[model samples]
Target chain A: MSRSTPLREVHETLGATLTDFAGWLMPLRYGSESAEHNAVRTAAGLFDLSHMGEIFVTGPQAGEALDHALVGNLSELVPGRARYTMICATGGGVLDDLIVYRLGSEEFLVVANASNYERVAAELTARGEGFQAEVDDRSDQYALIAVQGPRSQEILSSLTDADLAGLKYYAGLPGTVAGVQALIARTGYTGEDGFELFVAAADAVSLWQELAKAGDGYGLRPAGLSARDTLRLEAGMPLYGNELNAGLTPFDAGLGRVVRFDKPGDFVGRAALAPLKDVPPRRRLTGLVARGRRVPRHGYPVVLLTDGTVVGEVTSGAPSQSLGKPIAMAYVDTNLSEGLAVDIRGSHEPVDVVDLPFYRRSK
Target chain B: MSSIPEELSYTKEHEWVAGLDDGLTVTVGITAYAADSLGDVVYVQLPEVGGTIEAGDAVGEVESTKSVSDIYAPVTGEVVEVNQTVVDDPSLVNSDPYGEGWLFRVRIEGTPEDLLTSEEYVTVTSSEA
Candidate 1:
């Protein structure tokens, strides 16, 4: 059975279409997903990201513990800052992509994908056995909400006095929002300016309602997973199950920068990934845009247009509302990134190999 | 619940058939319930005009942003005409599923039977919902 988020009643009141995602019944969309996508691009859209996992590591050696457990140099991350990192098996396969926030000198918050949180928490505990830290899975205690787009700052500023303009990207500060305590972080998955609010589960509904009213004039509509997926896709961000999985290394996904081999400690996958830093994999993740209206869906084989040789498979795909065309992320031959066609259903639909991000927000 | 026109005959595949009273040619399209469930229709691949299709055969496909579904033939017949307008503007499948969004016209090959009435289609959709 899928679990419900704390804002389930609120989402129902808004007439959202609910779908089971990562064992949680979350809103798929409030109404038209395209409108929500456009809203985030031109205005702002709200998101309930409570399904994300929050594992806390506290003690004097929390940062060191994370550095040894994951692929990033978490100890170098200063307080009020966050780093996007990955946890990998000793053999170098990724366990999950994570965002580790250094809340304090001894406290670090590791936010993980909902489906891999249990494994991530367990891995942290096992990896930090010798470190002077306590690993706690407090995901249930927190509810995460994000306001993303060009108007996000304006919408968020109305409810909080937390130096929204001064908060650097990927930084967070503990502040009161709409009379409730929250850790407002300038982080987001969508390729837009945004703030992610981490609040107590009980305060979710009230905070959401307040933000809704405050953002009404700013065109902030409650967005769902459908719009979220499209926005992330347009931004070229990878979804956990789609792009980052236990079977693939970060290098395979062309995200080798997130793996910091020069960190002071010997971390998991350090030995395996260190040798692969300069070596290119057999296949590299690339983006594809269909010339026709037929969408390239997940698990569809990408082939060479000339010989029909199966080269790679699409990992994530959708009709891009912004591009006004079908876009997809696929792992194609590292040597050849052009002239690819996705065998959609049975027809080999031609697609062009484009750069990773299909869209970029203006700074 | 989606609207099921009383003048149309329905199939378990969620397609609606009209002009069955003529017993010579009929129009076929996906029901509104199917269109709503599929979200925005991005592409519609209709069977070729004059192509022969058997009842229950997968004739074409409807692609959405999130998913895709096959459009099956409601009755065995030759495809008389295809809606090029819907093929060009797929969103019509969602905005007007039955009228201007009609998928294709088929010349009936035999007596149209084993299809549901509008009331039966409504019952099916409600229960599924």
Candidate 2:
């Protein structure tokens, strides 16, 4: 059985196609996914991200506990800011990618993926045993809503007067939005200027309706997981099951910059990841642009056109509405650039190797 | 409630058979229910014209963003004509699934068995929903 979010009724009322995602029933799309994707690119789109887990770590040593449990140095993060970090096993394999926000001097909120939140909470509790921090799993109590896109600020400014102009990227603030209290964070996964409002579960519906009404004139649409997936794919963001997993480390995924070897304490994967930092991975993650209309899908083999040897596999793929072609992210032999073709179904369709991000919003 | 043409026969595989009463040539295309469930159709691979196929054989494929499904032949026949327009523009499968979205025309070789009527298909679809 899958758990339903607090906004399940709201989504159904709007005629959303709901699907089971990470043990939770969530909206897949409201109508045309391509139209929703375009709305986020040009205007703004509202998202129901309540399936994300919110784990709170509080006490005097909260930052210290996180530094020892995760890859990044959470103690270094100033208040009202968030950092995109990850948790790894002792063997240097990634456990889950996270966004840690420093709400106060002794309070920190760690947002984790829905599938891995329970394990993350357990691990945090066990790891913080000697420290003066307390870990609590509050995933059910919070409902997160994000307003993302180029016109996100304009849309949000109509609802809340909280210093939207002063809040920098990765910064968060506690303020009233549409007469309701929320932790409005200037963060988004779509590579757009957006805000993620974390409110109580009981207040999600009203908050959503308020934002929807405020954004009506701005072409704001309710985007679901389908559009969100395509938007993040075009932004070169790594998903947990697709790009990051227990078998691959941050270095293997080309995200070595997040690992802070200079931190004071020894983290969980410090020793294992320290040695592999200098050694290049066998296969590096790269982008693929299909030459034909056939969409390259997941688990498809990426091969060398010269000999049809399977060099790597596609991690995530989709028909990019922004690029007007099918694009995919795959792991190929390190430095193998030429003669690339994705084995689409049975036929080998030609694809061009491009950079990681297929699209970037102009700043 | 998807449209189930009373004149055409239906298959449990979500295909509709047109010209079945003519007893010589029948047109095959996925039902609207199948197309709606598949979401947006981005690519359609049609079978080669003038190729012999058996009943229940997977002839072609329909690729959507969320998933892909095989277009199966309803009866044993030789493919006489394939809809080139659907092959070029796959959105026709969602827009006009019963009309321009027809997959292929088959020169019937044997009797099609286990085919359902429009009423029977409506019951089949409603139960699944």
Candidate 3:
């Protein structure tokens, strides 16, 4: 039997097309993908991200333990703030990328990919057991709802009495939303100004309804995993399985900035990061724009036009929501010169090998 | 909630072929159901104009961020013209698939067999997820 999320009934009522994603039934589209995609860019859209995993680490040594477990520096994170970090293996390979939330000085919440929940939990438990922290898998107890877009604050403010304006990007607050207590974080995968709400599983249905009623005027629509994937891709955000995996490292995935080398304590992969810092990666992930609309897709062999040698492969691609062009992200030889062409199928096209965060919002 | 128009005939592989008054040429494209199944269509590798193809042969391909699907030829024919507009904007296939988003026109060299009629196609689609 297929697993249904808490909001599955709500999605069905809204005429959404459902598909099984990662062993869970997920809505693929609610309305036209173009309209739903535009809604997140121009207005607002809510998403049932209940399938996303949430883990909690609490005890006396939670802070120090987390600092030693992930590559990111977390000592500066005060209560109610979140940090995106990647856990590394002994050889500096990425175990999983996750978001660490500082719920308190001794309490931390880690949100991980759905498919990697148990693996993350197991890793966390094994690593954290040596410390005074207790790692608990809290995914079943909590549900995630993402209300994303430009008018997200305005729509979400009507449901809760908390000060929405004060929640800066990546900052969160433990507050009440739609009469249910939630951890409302101002961070999301979509490249939009939005909020991610974590509420009790039992309260999920009621809150989804209340928010739907309050957000009607803001052109608020319920988006599905389909729009979410395209939105993240257009933003040039990395999906764990697609852009990151056990074979990749934070440095290799263009996430060197998040790695904390100067921190006092020795983390899991601290000894290995020093060597990788100076050496360029074997394959660097970069973006590409195809000629016409024939965009290259994942696993599609991307070759160098000069020698016809297969240099890399496309990892993710889509018609960019922000740029209004077909764009793709690919992993190519790290030493491959800055400027080159990608073999999109048999046809070759020039591509700009540039820095990431391809889509930037107008500040 | 997406509706496949009754005027066009559809293939189980999701391509819809529409007969025209000019000749045996039929305009072909992925149906609305197919477009929805593939999410956002970022690219289309269209069959070259004047190229010949056999029925059930690989004429071209369409790709989204997550899926790559073959654009199967419904009938054996010579590719007459490809839609340049949809080539420049493949999302048109997702927005208005039945109308402005037609893929290409094929000059049919032989008659199509076992092609599902409008009503038959509807029944087939209605039973599908």
Candidate 4:
């Protein structure tokens, strides 16, 4: 049986299409996914992210334990700040990408992908055995809601006096929202100005209702996983299974900047990843825009239009509402730039190599 | 529940067939339930107008935002016409699946394979739902 989040009833009430994703019955969309996508771009959209894993690490060696376990230097992260990092296997392949938030001097929250949270939590425990820190999986205790878009800050400001203006990107603080305690983080995946509120699971329903009531006049629609996927795709963000996998390192996925080798101690994949930092990868993650209407989807081959030689493969793709065309992220041969096409189904559809992000919100 | 027109026949694949009694050509399109399940239709590929197809043959495809499905032929016949409007603007499938979103018309050669009535199609969809 798929576990339902606290907002399942609310989603059902709103006539959402629910699907089993990562062992959780999550809302795929409330109505038209395109409308939901457009709402996030033009106004605001709410998201139920309770399926994400929240693993807490604390103690004197909390930061040190994370530094040795993951790629980034967590010990250097100041309190109330967050950093995107990755956990790699011993062979330097990406295990999972993560966000580490330093809540206090010793408390840190590690947010991980829903599908890999159990494995990630177990790995964090095993990796921190010799250290003085403790790992606790608190995923079931939290429900995360995100308000994203151009009008997100405006809508959220009406609910709480949490110093929304003072909050910087990648920073989080404990505060009260709608009479419930929440960790309001000025961060999101939609490539827009937004906030992600992490609250107790018990308070999820009330907080969602409060936010909905407060956002009624601002055009904040409840978005789902479908819009989230397309929004992140347009923002050039990588999905774990689609982009980063057990076989590809961060460098191969064009996210090597997250791997910090200058940290104090030796990390898990340091020895394997250090040698690969300077060496160029054979296939680099790139973006492709379809010249035709047919969408090039995941696992499709990126081939040369002239000779039909397979050079790379698509990881994630969608009909982008922002670009008004089909866009995809693929790992292409670093030596080749132009004259590319994706073998969509059986036909090779022409594509142009574009920059990573297909859409960027203007500040 | 998605509307199932009482006068139409449906295939187990979620396609609706109309004009079977007219004896010349029958219109085919996916049911509203199928279109709703597909979310937003982005692309529609229809078979050639002059092509011959057997019943149950996968003639073309309907690509949506999240996934794609094959459009199967419901009856053995020659493809007489295809919906150019649907091909141009696939969102019609979601907005009006039975009318403007009609996929194609086939000149029936013989009796179509056993298809469900509106009531029977409701049962099939309800069971799946």
Scored against the true structure, residue A27 in model 3 reaches a CA lDDT of 88
DockQ of 2: 0.61
Give the count of colliding residue pairs in each prediction: 0, 0, 0, 0
Q: Rank the candidates by TM-score, best first.
A: 4, 1, 2, 3
The list of candidate 4 runs beyond 4 A from truth reads none
Assign candidate 1 its CAPRI class.
medium
DockQ of 4: 0.91
Interface RMSD, all candidates in order, equals 0.8, 1.1, 2.6, 0.4
Off by over 4 Å in 2: none
Better of 1 and 4 by TM-score: 4
Pull out the clashing pairs in model 3: none
What is the CA-based DockQ of model 3? 0.51
Summarize candidate 4's per-residue lDDT along A66-104 as a digit string, tens digits: 999999999999999999999999999999999999999
Which candidate number maximizes DockQ?
A: 4
Considering TM-score, which of the candidate structures 3 and 4 is the better prediction for this target? Answer: 4
- lDDT of each residue in A38-92, candidate 1, tens digit only: 9999999999999999999999999899999999999999999998999999989
TM-score for the A-chain in each candidate structure: 0.99, 0.99, 0.95, 0.99
- Candidate 2 lDDT, tens digit per residue, B1-129? 678889988888898999988678999999999987887788899889989988888999998777789888888899999999999888899889999999999999868888899999999999988
Mind giving the per-residue lDDT tens digits that candidate 3 earns over B56-116?
A: 9888888875577999998888999999999888889998999899999989986787677
Candidate 1 vs. true structure, TM-score = 0.98
Docking class of 3: medium
